[model samples]
Target: MAQPSLSMIVEGMIKADSPKPEDGWTLGWDVVVSYSEEEINKNLASRWEKHRDEMIKEIETQMTEERRPGESSDEEDERPTCDIKLELGAPRIQFVSATTSPTVNLLLPVRKGSSKWSDKQKTSILPENSYQICLKNIPLGTVKGNYEEIQDKNRSGKLPNPTTGEGECRFENRVPDHDPSKFEVSWVVLDFSMKEGDLNVQGQMAPGCELDNVEDGKTKVRLARGLKVVKSAAEAFFVGTRETKFSPVFNVLRHALVTVKNKELPQQVGGSRNLTPKKFRMASLKGSEVKPILSLFIHVVDGVDEGESRDLQTRWGGLWLNTKEDVMAPIPSTHTASILIHPKLIYKDVLSRSLASESNKGWRFKQLVGVEGGGIALHAALQCEFRMPSIRLQFDKGSGRIQVTVDDWSKDLKELPATIHLHQRAMDERPVISVNWKFSTETRRTNSRSEKVHPALDVYKEVTGDITRWKTTFKLAQDVPMKTNSTDYDITLEPDMGKLSQCWEITEEEGETDVWDKIKNFFRVAWLSNDEVFKDLVVESKESMRKMIPGFKLGEMGLGFFLTTNLLNPGAKVIRIDKDVGFRAPGNLLLVGHVIQGTDEVKSGKV
Candidate 1:
């Protein structure tokens, strides 16, 4: 049966904006490091070791200063928020550069046709046929170099000068090769910390904040909180480089060599209770986040971890994912060979727990160079799983039904029951008719011959009864129509003598018998009333049936008066009838075919 269905809503639970369980959530900075060939070579990687050493030294100095109770970083961060932006430049990944060049002043004699070559000696390529000379490829776009030269002496009017009286020239012809870290783009937690308020209110997001799993985040996540990350599809950050020679012959006879040592990030958790190895460069929170932790994790979406185990039991440990991986790394980014060859040049560290954003907006990451050492010369940032926040649900529509044990009636129903009951009483009750019904072993048929006569209902109707103290097989006394007609919505008992007869024997004084009644009264008119009677017994029976089966058209088929011989008169018949019994009875409605669909618009079930 299909009663018109309506969805039941449960409020105050999770909504559409809620994060899903599958999206990993963590509490750290989503660090993005970017670098370029120019920035990494001459600007950073060339002198990276020196810069790293200086950074380590600076960190050590600050660590010493921090140990002294009187020193504080607060004093340095006291600048007003407005001036800080003007004071700070773009977030930079810095490296040490050579303090001095290996150039010296020299005077060479001017020659005949090579006077032009001699004038531009410092920046030009070596002569093609010169001895002890080498050749190298220049960058694709550059056709000239930036070089400065000075005269050997103050010249007055003299004969045509040769070689422009060469003096000293100093210049840089090409950018040097550097490691990936030198090219890295980085930011500091201190900068973010001091200006957190400004960053949070900005209308952009730091790198890796935009994700489909994170709703409205493309607009909600802002980068004003931190610097935007440099990204490509293949790597978190990438920068191309070119091979060059200061002098055409420099790569041959005695190729110049520059060696920069690696700097170890010797960091220990200030407040942790766990024991970690002294040589550990990255923050090892007693976990295997090593292989999996990257400055940024790429391509993690519904398609990545679909069939994989995201459960605690199947995790690296018996713990859940406490970190949120980066979801926004660009698709075409790449990891350079510099990263593979020189790992220490890459700096990474986990920050304090408080640096993470409420949403995956950004992470508060740790840096090896420390807060006091961040600069264009120092490479510092975080490396760990980027865990973020998400939402989960526990219920759905197919859960069948539930039993609500409402403790406070007013709170749950909002006092609707009282109002409902009052309103229900205002509607008029349906009209009803009543009749008396009883069942007993005492029937009008007292002989065995009458029982035999009434045995075959298909043949004809006959009168039969029993006078013994026994219960009747019939449970109800139903109506038998005198004739078929369309006027009835109720059952009425009148005189019937075509085969079996039933009548109401009411006490009355017949002052005079009309001609029509006198003739018919002989066979069927055993009652005086024009219509069948109804009383409390019948009305109550109908009401009881209505209450028993809800949403039903009660009394549409007429009410059946139930009777029992158990209480009032044990051997007497309270209900009298002569008819077919059981499923074969004339008044009983029985469906005989297979029930498929239904046409009742008010309710459903039908045959």
Candidate 2:
């Protein structure tokens, strides 16, 4: 009974004629598991002594913090209860596939190389449908005979998987045995190239049915996009496949799912009786040849109604690389002209009980750089405010609203806090725009109070025409009087039109449409709003701002911004002169809107 040398396997059944084959008999039902319990022959009473010290320490600390309170818990005197159950559920759909599109490789250079940059090489993609979409499935078997073969192959293994080594994967497809109604999705395996959040697009069904690619020679088409919904657990099934460079790219555009069969197939002489959901599509052709892939379309077709609470999952994700799909040549063309650029701000902030800790706010500005080269560059600076709860809400009550607040309110917003500073010193201005958000935010501040004199105000000239019908709500902020470098003058102020609509383009009816006065005011104020010392260098300037910068200590901060009197203030922060912003290279330099941020570092360094 206690022999390690003697080994035996029980197989024969007590019933007679059990070995006889039958249609209802399961050939795989003969598997048995061996259990071990050598320690049962020894004593377990002494094992508790080994953990006795740790047990006592835990018990002693349980009452330390809560002992001061009179409240008690029933768990303290009586041990808590535990319930264990072994409920079984059906397995979910699981599939694995592979695809290739050389265009997906284009993202590598963009992600690895320095962004917002250009080289001698042209950014292009390989022909679209040139790459084949190869999908192979994994097989599932429970037969002892087949399992034994699999073990033998692995022992003399040239590869871990022998079935896929020479043959394809096959599985029996089945049907749902439950109800339908609710939906829940979760990812057991998540890999994202550029996923922002939840599933905005799945399969070919995108939000708003955007166009994916052109077909009628030259008609406009929407860009194809995809997002992941969920992933399954590895234990749900073992998945093994070759690693491909285009690994996640295929999933970003397409996906696979498992489903049950509606009816059983007639078990033929060679084929099994299982059925699976199958999908296929034809690729578009170009002039008798398959054209290179330019975009993707993600579509999802409902194939299973496995009852209430269906789960959608697949292994999905992509590598990081900004999405840019335009071609810009050395010379300008129709596509290169009048390009519309949209800026997106990504905010990252922390909420906390303390006002000082909560004020830490920052944002990331990301966009695909255009080829037009005339697009505006951007920089950000901001001051944050956080308001705490007030006790006054508890006393005043006609409203059923709960007026809870934080302990303190952060910095004041009256000073025009968030600003996107426009550094308009040159035209060849594609300066590398990586900024330390904290440092850049603090760099905008000056020791003198007049530095914040709203720049947008200087351009909104007093209305010469009749405005009796206009409400006071439309007018900008009031003016402020500040003296700088022995020059005392009142500089007009205006709220940031960024928070409102601002007209920078001029069309017909200048007075009725062009708010150039309102739009240009901020730059004038920002020019003069320099520090106390630089306020002197800008005093009734005879020479240009750029020429004088190299000779002075403050030149390192970059030049061109100077503000004096109304007549003396430069027309705009953006000025054209040789060597503008003191750039050493020869290229088209551009500056765009600026963003204001807050930082602990005050002194200016290379941003």
Candidate 3:
């Protein structure tokens, strides 16, 4: 047999100015439920009787309407199929946990007071003017039909119900039960200190509170068994503050009263978890901490599915008074699990800009706030273009070539081709530079009248030039081109006299006289410097000085040679003969060209 439903019994005391309370209070909730058979039970038989009458009426009306304004309503043989219900029971309540042990019962303190107060007195009464409130959880249980057995028997023909229409039907009900072994019964009593006009209590009362169990046909429990009172004072002190003028008490005490007369009620009877007001208040010079608390019960009706289990699990959830780490208390038996989380930021954003100068054109970046790792690594692509120093060059239109030999100049020339074509040059006070075009292929749109047929050219050229040659080319372009007729091209091609015999330079080395000669010939042909011959003469004179004197300083010998000859001259040569002392040259070889060391330097002349 299913266990009978349990109910709560409440008894309390309160002031006269409060709502009238019933004997006790109880709340009903389903822990497990069978399908709702209320409609099937309430209207099965009654509905069939009504359907029979309606069908007869409808058939008669249709028959009458079908006639030509004069039809007989004689065909009323049809009967309704539905039936009125003979049995319907009210919904029942189920306990969160079932009682496995027969001796299961609820235990609570007969008196509502703190442990500290209980130690002082087994039973204590409130002050004459003080308000008293009480709250506690009540135990309740439910009863339901054995639906599984009912269904099984129906399949076995123990219960008879028609498979087709126009017959009686049977339904199975699945009820919930509480396992007493699964629950820990404890009472949490709240004694509120409420002030006047601050507490409000409302409820329903039958033929007055004087009714017996059967006075009114309805089952009822006393919500606030006797009365609920609210108390507060405009001018109140913190304990003994009223007797001490130097006390730092600033705020008054606010209190409310709640009476608990039931033992098996759900949280719906208790209202919300946070019932305390959150109004800000000013404290005295010596501030005091305010700790707010909320209390509620968690009801875990047994035999519920996963969804209902999870939904009902959050019987109490909100901000607790303690930090998450400190809230290490064990979870209550009423819930599957409990979690307290504290979320915070890892890092903050630092707004800043690039550190390098604008000329560098190198992109710099800063880290965003709270990205990841200690330092986030990010990669982004940057494309930048900048202008290089301008190089202007003038070219000779005849040869259409600007020849230049540059040294010690470093610029990016990888993108430039070996040869360039000159088209334009810039002019300014600064010396001109010759720019050479590096050819490339590109497609560029052309402005056209017809939108459908846009045109483009496939040619791109860049200019690069050396500074000295750039200036010379610019000057040459400014002057008229030296004329050389096509017929006299050969004659004009012959090396110019001024350039043909120009001496070139050669440097001394440990070896390679032959190399020097080859280099001299090549450079002289090109009208380069005359240093090659100078190097040769210097090498020979040093040998001569070594032979004439032992252990002679190389620096002294170099100086001596410079004094004896214009060492800067590449065409210079020492006069000597085979087994002979002197050989004569045509021109003077004075060290300073006669102008510096001539006899009193004959009349100064200007070039």
Candidate 4:
């Protein structure tokens, strides 16, 4: 009650500027306050002067009674004291962009847990609870293209440009059309911050650091101790003639920042904020890729080998593909006139479809042209402009069927065209050209069910001619779908060869036709008894690779047909026949179709 000795009155004082949980920098505890014990004694000296003598004598006697020979006491404790300590709080988090020329400003959301503080002031206090940070703003970035940078003024708005010394590598004197192994990069910088009151730090503050490196000329940074950055999409690193043509670096980085943040992330906190932080999700690691389908320009000559067996598989002629771009010396003069002309061949739709699945965002088809001398060029005309829902090509040797897997399951029919070229000279050899037709044994079904499904093969002559001028023998299968209900069909003979062409429909139409013509044409009869007076009849073959073609068909219901044709002098020996499947189910059913298109090769001799 006697004011307890003045020496015992003072305790400790709290330091003001403590770091918050959201702050990016570190805080070390070393703050201190000085207490003036000597000063206080001097200021009160006059007032206690009279008793000073007695006080000194009594103090000296008590001090002497408690003193050891060489011990030094804490003088301030015996006199007066003032203490200093930082107010406890959490550290804040900040965003650090890998690139110097960062183009965008973004805010990462922080998931803070319930604070164990006694009051509001204590809530912002440091070392209270650790919070998780996440961001869900814009796309990861663009590839191979330039982009503008964006900044947010409210939070560390300073944008980073091409950071110095982050020298972009460029390969000098590389091969022609060769891309540099390295890349030029520009990035936008972002700084994240937090006020002391907003953070509740807990657990040992995590240690972190980052470093950058270059591989094959491209710049890449490594983080030693921090969250791994993930991209939402696949990014290309190398961009010479191969790898990727675009700036995949930015794509990967942007996707990492945006996509990863939007999804649920893993939580590292507990208690009132027990809601676990969502896990960070990443795109598949297989990455984006594409494959090329090949096209070969070949030339064939008869009489190269005249030994073995088999007519179609004979050992007479040899085939030559233009491995070199420029034309080779024309076949030796001797073989020139006798040269059975057949040039160019393609492995139709022969690339894996799965490779196109992941990179469907910008799916494209390309023709791989690898010359004998290593010269390569890509033709866009051969590229597939869009991705199918499903990417599968099916061919069964036993069934003699080909099925192309489509992405859309609703439609069972896919229309494809077949076009063959006949050299102008080949048409001059034979007067009356004959066409031989063949069919595959495989039957098509839809959704695993083969009920009444008759594959149809309907052929229409391309030349326009008088209906009565043409004579031909053909059967209308009852299973072929048509607008009309007819059983027998045939062609009639006309006087001139031109007349036969008149009855030929030249327009490119799909298997289905209008109701009027469908019914009208179905009943037409084939004229197989007419006299043959034509010579050297020829149809030219296409010079380019076989592209999808268009055509029309005449059909009768309840029947299906497959047709093959042989000219007087068959241009190419074998008409590589294959089936095309338009639809497929997991089990036994497959909706099959055909991609009949002209080959780039032209046949020079009679069929």
CA-RMSD of model 4? 37.0
Better of 1 and 4 by TM-score: 4
How are the candidates ranked when ordered by TM-score, highest leading?
2, 4, 3, 1
Per-residue lDDT of candidate 4, residues 241-314 (tens digit): 12224333322222111000112222221110111111111000000110110111111111111111222111
* Per-model CA lDDT versus the true structure: 0.17, 0.17, 0.17, 0.18
Q: Clash number for model 4?
A: 106
Per-residue error for 190 in candidate 4, Å, reads 6.3
lDDT of 3 by residue, 17-64 (tens): 111111100011111111111211222222222221121100000001
Best by TM-score: 2
Q: Candidate 1 lDDT, tens digit per residue, 502-526?
A: 2222121233446764565434423
TM-score of 4: 0.15
Higher-TM-score candidate among 3 and 4?
4
C-alpha lDDT of residue 561 in model 1: 16
Give the clash count for model 3: 52
lDDT of 4 at 371: 17
State candidate 3's TM-score. Answer: 0.13
Query: Any runs in candidate 3 off by more than 4 Å, and if so which?
Result: 1-350, 353-398, 402-607
Task: Report the Cα lDDT for residue 241, model 3.
Answer: 18
lDDT of 1 at 18: 17
